[model samples]
Target: MTQPPPPPNQPPGPPPGGFGAPQDPPPGGFGAPTPPPQQPPAQPPYGYPQQPQQPQYGYPQQEQPQQYGGYPAQPQQEQPPQYGYPNQPQQPVQPPYGYPTQPQYPQVPHQPVPGAPGGGRKLSAQLQIVIAAVVAVALLIGGGLWYANSGGGDEEPNAKGSSGAATGGGEDGGAGGLGGGGKEKVPADTKAKLAFQLPVPTVPDVTDVSGSWITDKAYVKTGVNSVVGYDLDKGSALWTLPLTGQVCGASRHMTADFKVPILFEATKRVAPRYFQPCTEVGLLDLTTGKLVWQTSITGGTAGDKKVSFSEVTLHGQTVAAGGLDGGAAFDLANGNPRWKPQANAGDCEDLGYGGGEGGLVAVRKCGSYDDPTVTVQNLDPLTGRPVSQYKMPPGVDFAAVVSTKPLVVAADVNDAADDGSGVSDFFSIDEKTGKLKAKITADSKRYAPRCRSTRVEGCTQVLVGNGRLYLPTEEHDGSTGEYGDETNEIVAFDLANGRMVPEKTDAGDRYTLIPLRMDGGNLIAYKWPPYDKGGQVVSIDGGTMKSTLLMENPSDKTTRTAETSFSSIGAEFRYGGGRLFIADTLISKTKASTSLYDKKYLAVAFSTAG
Candidate 1:
């Protein structure tokens, strides 16, 4: 038989609350009663006297209901308006047309008797009422089952032609709890025990996207040419220092030993060629939130534009800073001039990186961007003079500094002309002799260049720490001379010998690992959700390669929606004073009311304390 169509949409009625089973076969149709089966009288054992003959049995066992197909079909007969009861066995074929019909028995009310309404019980008016009540209960139960199996009242129609319950995202449309709203599931070990998170300060001109954390405070650059120190644990501003110069810039650095200096630079805010003749540098006493000492030194030549100070390293007792014009080293405690390294004539610019054993690295470009002749020099922190110098591979350009102390790690520009082939590498140089100690392996494939990553506000793909280098890259095929798939693999290489170390083979790929920093001998990183992949904080033991996933990315439904685009704000992740800070910036397709800043930023902090 054809099945019936489904019912139309309608507000559901009350829930079903009854129980029932299929009704028995209809009345009368039970079947013709069978005559009783004849049984021969038992003959006594041969010696016993024969028993007197017994009368024939009156009723034959009702012939087993005639089987139709596999399942038993209900007997055909009139159905009762309420509970349908099956027919009872008929009396023996009316013993030859009324041989004085066997005395008929009277039916009892509300009692079980054979072949009576409701199985021998006569249907008195009260009985009918009881049957109706039972039927009503059955209907109620069936209705309740229907309501439950259908979509409940909580769901809304999904835009994609389906439906889902509202996830109850938070203010930013991100789920509030750790694993709520379909966010990446947090591994048991690395789930965050948050210490605190401060409201991101609204700054007009944010000079630095990353924050520098000291004992209990973090220093950040504001838009209005100022640097502010905030209590990292309490989310309160401690102090603010304004830079008074034309093209001013500020940076904060904390050394391994906890020495911190707040560095500032600018040109005269005044007239002709408002040039930055000097950079004002100071060391701050974190506990008192006071500047221990401050001074300005004239090193690089002043010009029409502002002096750009790029790398700021706090090594031992020295503060090394460099800009377009030149670089300088100063006493960290008293701010006394150490040595000023000047750019030679025809040199494009001078840059500095932290050198091993408390030294410094200066990359001087002697050739223009087209010709590109670069020299790497290891400088003494105290003297600011070259301890050792070497030229980079012929046509290769200089990339960013990966490490400064104990061993200097730097990447060569990945352009075709630089390597003359498809390979790109990061080199570990011996600081004493400025010689290549090893050509570190970066990326996954042994022969391919590293993955060229777009600078995200807070994302860094390559990390140098302890004695190893961590690089995130896509697998490449050497024979084809082409990159393969998109599964980004993070490879760790020994800085000592530049050999790739084996990762735990049995640990199956969990999340995309991108190296972020080295903290307390642990390699800190952010993992992409294995399920819905993106930024998640994780820490890997540098030695074992074991990974632990920390805070998951806030549930961001928009990332999967067509209404918004995925982008990173390029805010650098920061780890210091036993805490990890993550900054995230995303743009929305929906418009918003006027605000001081065009966009908002999320700053989350995680702690290692028990």
Candidate 2:
């Protein structure tokens, strides 16, 4: 489950009436006859032979047509319409069931979930105590008769949080709860930030998004100073921060424990013009969008930072950032570094990994584009240091590498000075030390790496599950020696060891990666959905890539979310002008030519509380 956005000073409640999950029965949302879960077949109650059971006196089970499944139909007894409900459009009501289409009724908060028992049950994951009353098929038969007032409905009624219905996400950039129209509720203050940067955050500017999560947020490049944030809940911002140095990342505002949100922001900066291109990071409060802390990041410069930045993710008090300059871990409070022994060896172009806490691989590069060697460096999350210093063997000047999680693969070229025909290698770097763990050689020139998850630990066999590592690269896409676009072949490496995993083959093409949502055995990839020129996510496992529907256009169906902890929850991300994660989104969008100094920001909201 995605961590809930860090709790703010709980805003007031929202408008009473609004569209939410239907209060009526979940009548096969898409019309699939949901077979009653199989438990055990029906059985006799008393253990003795057959005998007619006595029906109750006042509240006997109504022998309505719905009470019997195989019995013959009786003569038509025209009865008055029940409860003023429609009779003309009478649905084929089953012996003991409700209508075909659900009723458009007001949601009574205490409705129970189907399949559960006991005068209505409640299962709040946040509460960590699920009240499950196992109802067997046999029991249900008797239960059907005994339940004139017991049709299970175990949901919290009015003014209750939709905590149970919440979902996991697959991308970055904290998301805003969109209105029905699919349009964002950006405020006037946000608009101004988009145009330019103010020293202090009058409003927040969000960007570097994965799905709606911010892989990275940049405050306008302040010569030495900077500002940035990881606003998880009230989603994306049109404006982005442009720090004049290497850009690391922060996470969304949510509590820790990976449940609720916890706000956090931290950055280390290297002043511009200090080291050819300095590596500077910014920290911002998500709620009000204000500056928190900043310091210089090394190994990568501003240009490197721009190229390396990824989304900001939250997991409890830990903020995991992967992109530009590999990935790093940080403390949500006070901007103190939590990760250690960071890349002091080469320019960390980007960072990512699969199936583990913090990060698994760091996309390390040395020299320049023309003579660059891009390799995946495995980093220890607990200490923020390289797992090992194994570098990809020399003579292999590579371009870029991408990861989903656990799996760290790269795209490389034999010789940068050579034409596009140069040999290309796509291989997995064992933990660290760049030893080829597993690899495949392919022919092509435009390549990129796409992992399955940005996490790396405790899942199936290897953190990187059963899948293919796709790299679409071009050769002339030069290792330019200078800053230039290089190209290489696009190849797909099967993640399965074959002996242990399934038989599979993947085609290579220009590919982009989106680790949207992969919880509960479901891995969803929203390929090139938004930031990618008309990207989409498809189910690469069960479905074929030939169909555009799978990876074509992504609906608002995503599930990636930030990791959280209590320590993280207590910290603030963006703010309304109070304390980020505590303040409100500015009302600048409500008026014209708005200035932070001119008027009070509008507190108009799409907040979880609001």
lDDT per residue (tens digit) for residues 146-255 in model 1? 00111111222121211111111111211122111222223545433455544444432322433345454463433234445666765467777555542233233465
Name model 2 segments beyond 4 Å from true. 1-279, 284-292, 297-330, 338-358, 363-376, 397-401, 416-423, 430-435, 445-467, 471-492, 496-537, 542-610
The Cα error of candidate 2 at residue 12, in Å, is 67
Lowest-lDDT window of 10 residues in candidate 2?
Answer: 165-174
Cα lDDT computed for each candidate against the true fold: 0.41, 0.28
Could you give the C-alpha RMSD of every candidate to the true structure, in order shown? 34.9, 26.9
Q: lDDT of candidate 1 vs native?
A: 0.41
List model 2 lDDT by residue over 1-610, tens digit each: 1101111121132122211111223332222233334322232121111111221111101111211112221211111111111111111122111101211111122456687876478546543222212222222221111101110123222111111111101111011211012112223232111111122223223211111122233211211222334333333343444444323233332442222111112333223522222233344543344445554333333323432334444443444455444444455554454542233323333443332343444444445656654444444444433444223434454423334243444343344223333334434433423233333433322222222222221011111322433333322312333333322222223332100111121222333333333322223333322222233333333112121123222122221101111111111222221111211212121334344333321111112112
Best model number under TM-score: 1
Query: Local error of candidate 2 at 338, Å?
Result: 4.8
**What's the residue-level lDDT of 108 in candidate 1?**
21
